[model samples]
Target: MENSISVVEGRTLHEISLQRKLWADLTAASLDFCEDLLQWSSCGNVAVTDTDLDRVVDRVLYMYVSEPLAYWLTGWFALACMNLLLQGKRDIEVFVFGAGPVAEAAILSLDHGAAHRILCVSVLSRHGISNQMLAAKLASKVHFKLDAVKDRTRLHRAGFVITATDAGAPLFEPHEISRNAVTLSLGIDDMPAEYFEMLFSQGGLAVGDDLVAMEARNVDPLSLYYSRRGLKLTEHGRADGVKNYSEILSDATLMERLKNWKGPASFLPVGLASLDVAVAAKIYEMLSITLSTKE
Candidate 1:
């Protein structure tokens, strides 16, 4: 598709070309970022000190946000493209409920998977900065009109509903949705038990960080963000005074178990894959490892 000039930040054709090239580089860079994360996480021989961990994470974010020198405009564009692809569902309609980085990430991931042109719905304050951006972005991509769901009627016959909103209460009651409909809660797992009960009783998917609740309701509480050191699942259900990744993982074995287990109620970590340069580099390293193992 010819790049839409309306959203293009440049005035002249040369400027536009420069912008496109920058964006292309951002996409490639994200791939490289992912690869760096995988290498640091998988490398056993390297001494993983606390200082090293700090540096690793900082480096990853620097690359992620394109901090000092590079602008993140291209990363955002590639992500936007991904969002369009996911909501391109044809056979069945998909609805999006939340409006943040994770929700946005999920939408982009869906696009990468070439989902059917799914209908998307999101909840936002009519005025919040994040919400407003989400609304505009969704408008740019999705064809359907954006409707504000004042009450429960918003759950109209959607095949799959993704709750990306940070609604403090149970977003939907158990019996409200169709039994066949899939409900993915892309929110923090520290919600009240009532939410889990509602989802479990009705048979739905809840994504969060609470392993205990996740186990109880058979929900999947997995986080997919990658850093140079390792993958990050927020420390939501853990105690204070935690030292390192080892401590976090050791104490959170139950959480890890919840992630590894396969069942309706269990949570699974669906690692986000980027075709960005950083991720590509990481994959190249992984391929090298696989080859070396074979040799």
Candidate 2:
């Protein structure tokens, strides 16, 4: 596979080589694409995949291909990369909250981190053994220094932070995140409730790859709050505070709004189907090109 397929960013996941264009495509998708996905029958160019019992696909524009797991991870990685796409390149500190089996996603992020000019990295694993393993796996792939430290300040100072742990409680405070930090919590338990509230509060911004997915799962506090609030004029359901990643991609000023935001920003890539569909489409294209070349 390494000989035939191009490797994606990061020392791991050699089966996938994510082209930068995928980042641009993920962003370029508009609200219409989302609407199309929802409406189903009217969806012309866009593709839709649903796990729900009310599944809808009137006409298939594309078939799902590429390894499902690889494309899904790629899609999820793209969702987590809203900050990189919006803000462009910058030197950043990288922090990983859990480095056990969940370490792969954080490791996948290193490719983007390298592009962003990572200054240093600090990781906290389930037992610290995974920390060393993560560092060792990365030693040959990245040039930047990775220090396994329990320092809480690493989370505070990190320009890029990821939480792969589920400790049954929120891991960090809203203030603990730097004013402009980009954090990606793989699941719900990685972040505090206040951090979700911060998305509605001043200076903070909230972004998600797939609205249906974000709204469906309890990815974090916001998803749960959104579920319970549901069209109500509740104080927590501040419509103006949220922006879809596709909407931002179509509008530079919108992306800039989050990039220049004065508070902590997070990207919750929760939906399984959309990320899988978006990424699978792109990966299929890439692999098709490779196969055709061989023929």
Candidate 3:
């Protein structure tokens, strides 16, 4: 007896064929091979020959780039925030503005390692109730609060704040920021020009992953707005001040300097390709070891 397949099954088969062809082309070109294989496997493309799949896996192990970009980016940001928090007192209050993927990653990063030090976490978003409820389940020990962005008064209580939204305008003014707060701006235009001016004026530091790249793209709202207002970003030696993640991570004296900061310090991390590559390589190494152990 023969069996009949539904329209959905037929369509799925066609998709699988197209996906296999695409993966073959990508693998042949040696373009993001590990990422492509991971993606292909995710689609449950079982028709791929075991020999070819094994070869691809071996190549990925040799190349050492296997993890997703989001994972590493989250780790780097979290590490930077943790380092900054360590410079100050313990018992920190963290506030995340925008409940997007990046914000969720930051929340997870903070919760996993620093729960003991983190007294409370407040997530301000349009979907505050749901995010707050989800966060409650994820980390019961860390107190969670759901608040709207309009609650300006709550901003002053946060010791560590991270902005992870694509809003074209500033979310909060500089005056609302608490003294000695460690703020990391992950979104393109989530911070205002006044905030940058205030950070520099108060002898606090403002750093980025790559200021040259950021200025070249002209997507950073703070830089564009400040440039339009006749506030020279580079001429005032602020460009010289922009430091990358490696610099921040390697500098032994940075923590001590940060400890003495009298006002808020801001970090603007424009995602870097190197970070993604490094993270992928690390994950690949770990997976390779696990597979070898199983064999």
Candidate 4:
């Protein structure tokens, strides 16, 4: 009766708990699948779509299966960026800029050890605590520290930051960012304009899923100028130029650039059709096996 009781909307209390577990497992799976895909010798090219996935319907799923997956893909890309930024580095201090599974997934994907302390900074009130507890519960080797946004000092020590704040203003000051920091930023507004100013003043690297398509679409700070409203058809800064993430991984040059890149760099990995398809396919495959064995 307890599991059957409807709490909110159409979901029962049972479904809500299942959703949390699914979020964590799916996060881990997405990261592993992407990493394996990168190393697959037969893999050739990746295609991406900006379209939302909504064909499947479930009372419990809500928008989780829809196009919002684009947002989670941004966090998955954080793995590639972190590896490049902190190569051969030990005792890495990872600071995640958002508290949800999407941001925590970045921490979950990282190399686990005694020395790694992941400082997960969140803006959510109670929801933030819920996510962190689930993450800390699931985290065996890695330590997940939940810190509020008001305690912004944690950002200063982050070597690899996975940010999914999707914020409209600076969560932390520009000076707080660690030198030569690399972040997987979900959008242009994830950090303050002043931060970008500082990055561009020195030298910063920027990458994406498909930069040319993004340039044509006029999304993200990669575009020279953009409007806050009025069709975003007019909406859109920093770094020498924006390169595609896949291409960077495919070649050693850009990874090398990221290795030696100075100042603070950010990555925008959302809106890629490739990522959505990959994640969807991976989740389906994994879930099917999990459901089949009743594990």
Candidate 5:
């Protein structure tokens, strides 16, 4: 099958070339071969092969696609946190609810100098332990105090709360969150319906990449829950008061809405296929440049 991959950035979808058989045989691959592949793919000069196309696509999707997408999402979260800090004009405390891959990526993406403090809370002991190790490794770069805490008190203090878990229910009560707090929920069902209702009732800002797509897929936990309860996406649900990311133009505009926020502001980014393509395209460009310099 002939495939044309495209990445959506803001409102535009740009096409990207796929490197045919880039990992033709991983075990027998050499640095030069990898470098050449990168150079070719980056320039959109690679060819397509009919043989083992399915296998190639599978490997690329699972291995290459996932990481870049995670990184992209994390980058957005970082920017949002920065914008929130800029709007509030104060030192910001962050609470990460999960220690999973997405959470780790967000932690890695944070500007250490900008963040005042970071607290990571995990229901799973193993995740907490792993995040503890990760925090230690990141200590040199991170100027803030990174703590893996069992206490939930920090949740009330955090101005930025990120939920990246796979939990089936809400982790904390909506009332616990600070009035001016900004919460980014990447987990499917992490935040309960009540939380969203509170956000909407209080005139807090709600943002998402594509709430329509998430609801159509029936994969988003909040979307599914609200559907079962006979609520529409724009009424007391995940998409309630949600503005698409594409609509956001500048940090100043974001801050304008945030200035009057009397309750928890939220960002719910359900992973988009276009984001994977976008990140993959960026990697291709970088690899090409690196290979060219080496040669």
Candidate 6:
């Protein structure tokens, strides 16, 4: 009977295959959890292999099928907005009209070259820093000021406006802004349904940035990355041998996305104490993608 099968290294080939399949199932489950966390679904494919499992134990390290796609879409839209404003004979004055997390993230991400000048206008209700303080911190390059209520005559003449506020209602009244101004709303969901009715009624260009949907896409990369390292849980105390970040992020498209992205982004194995190991793996993944391009 097949029951006579002998075990090698304390396990049989069938056991190894079964383990791999179970690991795959675990990977799928983890991806479901992350999808729940991100509130979205995969926009790209996730590939799992033994190599990916060697490095992560009881953890998922996600990678993106096309990590740069979102950024590309965002950058292109931003450039298009800039071009629209420039063509309308408006000076490149980027007005930030709210104080929120996404707004703060954009402020943190902005480099001097992205926009000629940035003006952060806020109401007294919002507390972060006065526009003046922001200008001082930004080396006197970015202009910051209090949000005026009596009249927005200054904003009406501006070239660009970004409503980065979390306000549930419209920030600017339709027909209240410059006809040539390019407007973007980042923090709101279903922006068109919510605020664009008035903007459209007034003939203003309204763009929506759905970051939550973007987060949902490609969340499974973590699972594939972790599974490649041979580090998932089992009867053993803890399986060893995990791949570095480089092994994960080095995918061709991912590296391209990181070319100008100086922000903090990485993949870490669960149950890891030190970030050093995870960071090392991330770098390795980035390099791997870069090297593949040359080949």
The numbered model that scores best in TM-score is: 3
Clash statistics: count for each candidate: 31, 2, 0, 7, 0, 40
TM-score of each model, in listed order: 0.39, 0.64, 0.67, 0.59, 0.66, 0.37
lDDT, candidates in the order shown: 0.39, 0.55, 0.57, 0.51, 0.55, 0.37
Candidate 6 TM-score over all chains jointly: 0.37
Instruction: Write candidate 6's Cα lDDT for 227-284 as tens digits.
Output: 3344221211112221232222224554454333322121112211122233334434
Q: Candidate 2 lDDT, tens digit per residue, 117-147?
A: 6677788876668788777776766567777
Question: Candidate 5, residues 163-257: lDDT per residue as tens digits?
Answer: 77677567778888787678877677777777777777787777665656656665555566568787755445534556655444234566576
Evaluated against the true structure, the overall lDDT of model 4 is 0.51
RMSD of each: 19.2, 13.9, 15.8, 15.4, 10.5, 19.2
Candidate 4: misplaced stretches above 4 Å? 1-31, 34-72, 111-135, 138-150, 216-239, 260-262, 282-295
Candidate 2, run of 10 with poorest lDDT: 10-19
Per-residue error (Å), model 2, residue 255: 2.7
Q: Candidate 6: what lDDT?
A: 0.37
For residue 7, model 2's alpha carbon misses the true position, in angstroms, by 41
lDDT of 2 at 15: 14
Q: Model 6: which ten-residue window has the lowest total lDDT? A: 264-273
Residue 60's lDDT within candidate 5 is: 44
lDDT of 1 by residue, 69-100 (tens): 11121223223322221222344444555556
